[model samples]
Target: MSTQSVPVLAANDAASYLDLGITLALNNWPALTLAVQSNWGGPTSDDKRAWLCGAISEMLTERPETDAEDLEDVLIQVMNDEFDVVIDDESAAIVAVEIMEMKQHTDRGNFTEIQAMWEAYQLKSQQKSASAAMFKKVDAKDEDQETDDESDEEGEDVEMGDAPALVRAPREKAEPEIDDDGFTMVKKKR
Candidate 1:
């Protein structure tokens, strides 16, 4: 009899893999990415995204029977509650389906999709860093030009016209009066 080996993943290991897949799936989702990038969830948007990943992982782990529709509903609800965004582009459904597929693959100890997503993520990050560096160089040049222009303007004399002399209204000082108890009291002008 021919023997065949079947891959067996531990419970914790499977959960960890599923969590990673969920993170990568959320990262690639345009709606969620836009929300996080635009700070729609406020200054803690990044934290919110992390929290969402954990929440989704927990939901999937706790409810193994969760389907794409349920996942989609959760995604839409979260975007509305956390980011104040209503998704109407059906992107949430697509992401949900992808995540479900990821779950299936990870359950079988097949991480091809996860590995591919990680590589793509790395490439995207590198591109973003390069673009940011280019922008910084451009901004530095602009700042240097502004400083040079300011220094040149400093040597130029600005003409001022003579103005009329100002007259001040004289104020009458209130004299303090002594009360029956010998306490000094001053009355303010109405």
Candidate 2:
């Protein structure tokens, strides 16, 4: 009979996995994704998101007894500080709860949730890339059509009618009166 022993996860390894789970969870977060995609945290929005993941992981690891409420507060504060966003829709709370669950699961060496999140993120990225490609193709076609139209227009002489001459009423020049405060004062025209 052959006996096989399951590999045990070490403390450091578990912490690494927890960090990975936190990163995956943050990446899949719609609010953070949108903020990064839209450059909400300036040009380095992506970097900000990465920093946020690190911060969350560090907080969880350092404070093992941290609850979801604490996590939610961190999320809200970071969003406001880094992305200049105010999250009042309770999405931060939801993300915090998810992260807490991920932390618990990862601590126990169960990475099923993380794996599923990774797969979903990959699928979403692929779909976004496909959509961008399609948009580019359509845009390229539009540019080609515009170029053809411009070429056609270049082959013909365009007749532009004479524009109407602008007419203006002549105004009488008025001398400005100076006040004691060295300010120019003007009387209303009668």
Candidate 3:
């Protein structure tokens, strides 16, 4: 059974349908069997019908608590591997119909569980990104404020410590000279 022949359904549609079918099969066996037999051609040899059966049953019984896409991915893998037999389009259509019928029995509770899990995951992801972005903004603001404060302090220090210009005038005014008092001392020269 080569995998090249099986038709691929759209991601969302396929996931939803598989989830629904599995949900339904778990609740009712006889009905599920009838549904599968009616649509799928009883069972094919050299192909894995068990996965299809199991998927049907589990969907009805367990009703996935997580990603529906994950469950559908499992189904696609099984179909490609275990049931890769080349069949006519009509048979494929029949298989699809059976799957669709099984989907009808999907438990609402399963949907709710899966949906909640997905939503939580998405919310957590959003929160993480938002926090990171906010931190970046805050850090930038802090850096800017620090730069401003540093510049202001440097300016004040420069103004107060400008002694070169003020000290020269004071030193000239306090002219030191040799007076007649027999001592070299600084005097207020007129």
- What C-alpha lDDT values do all the predictions have? 0.84, 0.82, 0.47
Q: What digit string (tens of lDDT, one per residue) describes model 2 on residues 1-190?
A: 0001113335457676677677777876788889988999999998888888888888887898999999999999999999999999999999999989988887788877766776676687789899999999999999999999998899698889899999999987888889999999978869
lDDT string for model 1 (1-190, tens) is 0001112335457666677778888888899889998999999987898888888988998999999999999999999999999999999999999999999998898877776776787788889899999999999999999999999999798787778789889887767899999999877669
lDDT of 1 at 179: 96
What digit string (tens of lDDT, one per residue) describes model 3 on residues 73-169? 5544554454443333333344444444445433332344334433554576689789999999999999999999998888464546645644443
Let me know the TM-score candidate 1 reaches against the reference structure. 0.71
Ranking of models by lDDT:
1, 2, 3
Off by over 4 Å in 2: 1-13, 158-190
Each candidate structure's TM-score, on Cα atoms with residue i matched to residue i, is: 0.71, 0.73, 0.28
After TM-score superposition, what is the CA distance of residue 102 in candidate 2 from its true location, in Å?
0.7
